[model samples]
Target: MILLQANNVMRRFGADVLFHDVNLQIQEHGRTALVGRNGAGKTTLLKMIAGITSPDEGTIAKSKDLTIGYLAQDQGLDSQNTIWAELDLVFAPLHKMEKQIHQLEDQLASLDPSTRKFQLTTEKYSQLQADFKKRGGYEYESRMRGILKGFGFEEDDYQTAINSLSGGQKTKLALAKILLQSPDLLILDEPTNHLDMNVLAWLEDYLKSYQGALLVVSHDRYFLDRVVSDIYDLDNHTLRHYTGNYTQFMEHKQEWLTAEWKHYEQQQKKISKLEDFVNRNIVRASTTKRAQARRKQLEKMERLERPETDDKSIHFRFYSEKDSGNEVLDVEKAVVGYNDQKLAGPLSFTVRKPQRIGIIGPNGIGKSTLLKSILDRIPLVSGTIKLGANLQIGYYDQEQQQLHPEKSVLNEVWDDHPNIAEKDIRSLLGSFLFVGDDVYKLVHDLSGGEKARLELTKLSFKPINFLILDEPTNHLDIDSREVLENAINEFNGTVLFISHDRYFINQVATDVLDMNALGIKHYEGNYDNYLEAVNKEKATNANQDESQTTTTKPKKSSAQQSYQQSKETQRARRKLQRRVDKLEEEMTVLEEKQEAIKEQMSQPEIATDIGKLSDLQKKLDKFTTQSEDVELEWTSAAEELEKFDQENS
Candidate 1:
């Protein structure tokens, strides 16, 4: 059954139409996601569907008695009641029923057994009890507790007054309350905001099993991929539905665009040919009839509109004037904190040239603090940080404090490089989507996304070989994030950045740094890779625990067995180390071969020689493939060896 439907929904802002002739529907237990570029009217559409606003040109209809629980982006609860009390409001009807049931029970105890009043009271009491059970009266508190805990509210926090909670906490409480209500349709806009990785995982699981249909609007591609099964892309003043997760949607969208462009171009060619034939023959007397027929056919034909292109994105590449040394940065036993208070530390890590390292951790675990310490913006409590020779560092602050808010957007970039011409400065700003009159806007007036783009424009303008970024994707839309990812991948530099955007990390990270308050754990791949390794570690630990519990050996035998296991582990480590060394040697040789072939291909004589160039290109390709294989093997072996050594130590 269709729970809700929007037909020909049209919204307008002032004189301009945001979108029109929009249509969407949600069936019972449907999971739909609304996605679009920033300012493409996604939130507005959601608000219209949630009945917070009215559409200008269409109707939104829902099933009779349909209930909707809408959680807007960053929508917080404003209540004087305690956290538990606020959530307990969801059970008000049940509470009232329970009260009446108790009153009925009290009356039954005093009334005569054969009296009509007693019989009527007994019947009412039985019906109330049945209704209470059907409505989950007994499990409501436990359900509330489960939801509150899932949103990170503990029993201790239950009594805390809602007015005292932080904005993020209040938002969480609002979500918890709405979830407990369990409306027939749950509408969430950016619900993943302010949620930690663990909480995000929990929410994903919870929503997967949710009883109601879900309609969410979020830029979190990873979360959407996990939670939503369908995607509704609002673009170019229209909505297009795709039947898959975000990843699959991207694939299907590309294919669809390709096909649409092809069809459009083909129709254009046919129209052009017909028009040309008519123009040439229309003046000739003998062929005037044919020309008229062709003209009639042309008049009867329908022309296809040009396919919309996604060219409205900021486009730029990251370039380095010079290369940094092989060792870009090295931090040993580093403790990062502020004012004698430790946040996260006793950490050690090394960044090599051309490596993009993504640092991830729960909120407030000091991932950003680590970057500041490395930049010497804050003093480290202990340990040392060293930068290798010829290294030029570029930092992108999450707070964007580096940007002078008082300066205009054009002046912001121009002030940094005064030698550049005004035209060039404007051109650079234009590439970042700060066009015509936009460049004159003060930095303070720009939106968060605009400031982010402007900051990136400045970063791109510099000639640096090392990038240290903190939450770089904080305010970027999905398209802008993809552009930034491409720029980072094309950069010939080392990058150490902190990000909570898993899709961005997966796209750009060469390694993952999992940080915690206690310490840091290094993983060899992206977010999914980190999760895989973590699961394997958990399984191994569980197995060890089970073995310990079931062990029957004496203490001495166990000690000897441990010693033998240690020896075997050492042997395995040695073998892995040897494999790693050999692969590294192979990779070095393959890289040299590739460079030599490229140099040969670059020669003026060889460049002009097609066969010679082709042969060298094939050789280069073969060596590159081999190099990638060897690197993968080396990574696997090195990770295994690192684990073994850490275990033994």
Candidate 2:
């Protein structure tokens, strides 16, 4: 069943047509993502669906009882109310029903049981009670609390006034309220903008398990991939649907575009040949009829336009003057914190050159503060920060304050690096998606994301070996983020950055610097490896804690010693089993290779070649013999491991 449908939607702004003859149908429980370029009619279409703004010409239909909850980019809540009070509004209906039921119950206790009016009122009260119970009204408060907590609102902040909260905090609170309402359709615009990695993951899980449909407008590729199963691309004043996640959509779209381009090219070639033939033969008396026919066919043929490309891509290049000595940054007794809270310890650590380090912590922690202190933007209470020799740093600040608001986009790059030519500056800005009129736009008028791109453009144009980036993925769409990630992966410079984008960190980070209550702990691995190490450490700690509680004193009994020995033996057997599993995987590869060779030998053309046939036979025999040996070893190890487990049990 369709939850909402819009037919022949036409919307325009002044003299420009945003979209024309657009038709959209949102089905029940559909998860759709809206995507397009910056000025595309994505947000405009969403507004029409939300009924916040009327389309110039369209008919929108919704189910009789359907309810929609729209979260715009700038979510405005009642500033005077507290966060708890705002969330409580979601359960206002239930609260009213409860009050009415309570009043009826009081009247019934005081009235005669035989009165018809009293009996009717009592029956109505009972029905209301049942309805409330069915809707989990009794646990509504707890459910609201849970939703708020899941959205990263703390218990203390719940009582804080909404007016005191920051813009990002208010957006989170608005999202919590929307979730609690349980609307039939959810329209979210840039929901992941203010979310951290953990909160983003939580929201993803919630959306995946939600019963209603979702129409999200976001630039976060990873978030879209997790929450949306379909994409409605609003481009060129038209809508195109792709039935898959973002990655699959990219693949399918690429394939379709490639095929279309090939057909278009072929047609163009044929048209060119036909035109030449017509030109040469039109003057000949013998082929006049044929020439005329070809000319008519050419006139009727439809021309194909070339696909648009991302031409405004900055040419990113890095230059290293001299490889820094061992240490890139050194901090000693760093007392870093805000007004009343201390996030980490006053400890010391060394950052080495050529190390791609990732700083991770919860939102509102001192991660950003630490970066500022290192750059001398913020003063630490007590610490000495040392930089390596000749360490010219290129910083990508999340706020992008380095950009002058009055300057044009083109001038922002060229003014800083005066040595660069005007043409080269234009080319650089173009690479970053500032083209034609976009280059002339004032910095103050640019969107938050566009400013970020411009900052990166400037950084890329400069020659620097050390980079300090904070949330570099901010304001970048998925494709742009992927391009930035690729550039970073290929860069041969030292990098220390803080980002909540797990996908970005996983792709680029070579070392993990975890900022927790215990201070900055260095782990030598990528994000996945670091997570595994942390999990293993947690398991070990849990085991130690359990053992400490169970055995406060040393056990001197012979049976206890034997049990411990048996446990050790079982662990060793499991380790051997893992090795045997590895060997079996290798053997499977060999068998697959042997099968491929046999299939090739069975081919008629290959069978005609004696030399190739002999080679295949030899390879098959070798693999078969190796497979048998692997099977034997695997079986023996399995049996031994099973015996050890049985003994331990």
Candidate 3:
């Protein structure tokens, strides 16, 4: 069944048309995503479909009795009630039914058993009970609690006043409330803006099992890929439907664009030939009739317009003028905090040359604080942070605090590089999409995305070997984020950044630093690899626990048993240690071979020979596979040895 439909919708802002002839439908239990670049009228169209605003030239129709729960971008609750009380309002009808049932019970107790009034009251009470059960009255509180917990609210937080909560928390509460309402359709705009990885995972799972249709606008590609099955790409002031996840939609869109361009080009060539013939031969006496016939054909033909494309995005690459030492950064037993209070650590980690490390943890666990501590912008509570030689660091602040509010966009970059020509600076700013009058806009007047682009322009203006970025992808659209990823990959520099974008991390991070209140755990690969290793470790611990619990042997002398266990443990530790050492040696050899193959491939002479390149490429692939296998084996063996030592010690 169709839950909602927008037919021939047109929205306008005075003389400007945002989008026209937009059409789409939401079916029962549909999972749809609305995607586009920033400022592509996605939010505007969503408002019209959600009935928060009216379309200027079309109708939005919905199924009879349909209920919509629309969550605007960063929309928060403005309520004076306690958190629990606010959520409890969603079950007001059930509560009222419960109260009536209680009143009926009281009346029944006081009335005569044979009276019609008593019998009528009993029937009414039973009906109320059935209705309440059907409405999920018994499970409402539990369901609310589960959702609140998923949003990071503790039981103690239930009594907290809604007005006192932070903006992000209030937004979370708003989503939680809407979810509890369980409307016929849910419309969310950038719901993942304030969510961490853990909460994002939870929300994805919840929406997968949601009982209603969903229309969401999000820049989180990873979330969209997992939760949504249908995509409506709002581009060039129109919507195009594709029946698949975000990845599949991209593939289909690319194919469509290619076909559209080919057709347009073919039409353009035909028109050009006809026009040329008409222009050159119409004045000739011999070809007058032919020209007239060609003109008639041209007049009857429909011309194809140019294909539309989105090319107004920032483009730049990060490159280091000089290389840094192997040790880019070294943190030894570092504890990061504020006002002398410890937040996270004692942590120890070493960043080598050209290693892009992604720091991840819960919201308040001090991932950003650790970055500040390393840069000496904030003092570490204890321990040391050392930077390697020949290093120049560029930091991208998530808050855009580095920009001066009073400064023009042109001055923001030009002031930093006064030696450069003004025209050259303008050219550079134009590449970041700050052209003409936009270059003169005040920093404070620019949007979040504009500020982000301005900041990136500044970062790219200098030569740096180390990048320390905090939530770099926060304000960027998916396209811009992908561009940033490409720049990072192409750069010959070391990077240590904090981000909640799982897709961005997977694309750029060569390693992950999983921080906790206790310490930081190092993983040798991307986010998925970290998860796999963690799961494997948990399974190993579980198996060890089971083996210990299931062991049932006859009791032996205390001295003998102690001796035997100690001896056996020592032998096992030795064996594991030897295995670890052997794996480490094998890994080193494999890595060296891979590096050698890469060096050979990079040579100019070898690069020009197709046969030689192919043979070298095959060798490189084989060595790369071997290296990864050995690396995994080495990681496993080292972890086992570490666990054994900790337990047996």
Q: What is the alpha-carbon lDDT for the whole of candidate 1?
A: 0.87
lDDT of 1 at 128: 97
Score every model by TM-score. 0.83, 0.77, 0.83
Which is the better candidate, 1 or 3, if ranked by lDDT? 3
Q: What is candidate 2's local distance difference test score?
A: 0.81
lDDT of 1 by residue, 104-217 (tens): 999999999999999999999999999999999999999998988888878999899999988988998888889999999999999988887888889998998999999999
Predicted model with the maximum lDDT: 3
Candidate 3 has which clashing residue pairs, if any? Answer: none
- What would the TM-score be for candidate 1 when compared with the true structure? 0.83
- Per-residue alpha-carbon lDDT of candidate 2 for residues 481-585, written as tens digits (9 for 90 to 100): 777877776566789999877667766777888876557788876665576577667766666776654544443456335534543453466456656667777
TM accuracy, model 2: 0.77
Task: Name the lDDT value of residue 532 in candidate 3.
Answer: 61
Off by over 4 Å in 2: 8-10, 57-59, 114-118, 283-285, 299-305, 309-315, 338-341, 347-349, 406-411, 419-423, 435-442, 523-649
| Tens digits of lDDT, candidate 3, 616-639 | 999989988988898898898889
Q: Candidate 2, after superposition: displacement of residue 124 in Å?
A: 1.7
Which of the predicted structures, 1 or 2, would earn the higher lDDT when compared with the native? Answer: 1
